[model samples]
Target chain A: MPIIVNLDVMMAKRKISSNELADIVGITAANLSVLKTGKAKAIRFSTLDKICEALDCQPGDILEWQNPAEKT
Target chain B: MWNKHRSLKLSRILVLCFSVMIFMMTFFVPFVADWYEDVSDGMGLIGGSVYVPMMVTLYVCEGLAVWAVAELHILLKNISKGEVFIERNTRCLRCISWACLLAGGVFGVMALWRFLLFLPAFFAVMFGLIMRVLKNVFEQAVEIKSENDFTI
Candidate 1:
């Protein structure tokens, strides 16, 4: 839960839609939605690799660890 | 070759038949107790004396038996639908286990008065333990399945 997915930010910066990114990464849009919404427990490295390859970004650019208590 | 579906269907039918048999026995309790006294002349007094306790014991056990069987039927229905390891099935198993324990407890108290009740009391305790174990297994499985589902 502390691991946050910034996928939507990256997608917006890259001007890519969820459906398009999902197609390029060979995953369903529902899974992309799960990743974007931070509802996924853990993302597979292969899927991460595909997402980075499609978005032209590093994993660090798409993922962040922010402690809720430290947000202030 | 017999399959799991067929086996479950058979179990459902068997439970239905047992429920019917229990229902019939409820109506025949008084007659059966009277006949039991008549069958053994020397033990007639003992039979007559135990009649009320016997009826109470049988009715209570039979009521629990109906409840347990209904729980089993629902559990089997869910399993046949490929819904094993769910919380509902675990709940059904829990209900069946408690029913067995309560029925066993009834017979156990009756055993204090008549030693003949010990046999059923022991059987119910063992059955309840088995069902409790099964419920625990199902609860664990459901937990694991949810964790797996969330790991995207």
Candidate 2:
């Protein structure tokens, strides 16, 4: 939960729609949605590779880690 | 041909049959007790004196047996529907295990009056222990399944 997915931000910056990104990433729209909404528990390296290749970005660009204690 | 579906169906049917048999035995307790008394008369067992207590114990055990069988029916239904490793099945197993243990406790107390009753009490406790272990396994499986489902 501390690891946040910034997939939607990266997707918006790249001017790609969710369906188009899902098509290029070879994953279902629901799973893409799960990633975009930060509901996924973990991401596979293969899936991360596909997403980075599709979005022309690094894994760090789509993932962020924020300390839970910092929120308080 | 025999398959998983047929096996589950058979298990459900057996649970149903056991339920019905226990239901019918509820009404036949007095007659059965009288017959038992007659048979035990020559064996030096406590005959007519323990009739009322024996009937009460038998009814209680039957009620617990019905509870356990009904939980088993639901569990089998869930498995037949491809819903194994879910929380509901664990709950059903827990209920069935508790029912078995409670019936065992009842039987154990009755065994003080009739030593032969200890056999059934021992078997019931053993069954309950097995179910409890199964429930623990299911709980762990359900947790892992949930983690896996959300891992995507």
Best by TM-score: 2
Candidate 1, residues B1-152, lDDT tens digits: the string is 89987888999899889889988988988876666445533322233365667678778888998899889889888888999878999999999999999988998876765666778899999999999998899899999887776655
Per-candidate Cα lDDT values, in order, are 0.84, 0.86
Off by over 4 Å in 2: B38-48
Model 1 residue runs over 4 Å out of place are A68-72, B32-48
The residue-level lDDT of candidate 2 at B90 comes to 97
All candidates: DockQ: 0.59, 0.68
lDDT for B106 in candidate 1 is 93
Native contacts kept, each candidate = 0.62, 0.71
- Evaluated at residue A37, the lDDT of candidate 1 is 90
Interface RMSD of each: 1.4, 1.1
Docking quality class, candidate 2 = medium
Poorest stretch of ten by lDDT in candidate 1 chain B: B39-48
Q: For residues A16-55, could you state the per-residue lDDT of candidate 1 as single tens digits?
A: 9999999999988898898899888878899999999999
The Cα error of candidate 2 at residue A15, in Å, is: 2.6
Best by lDDT: 2
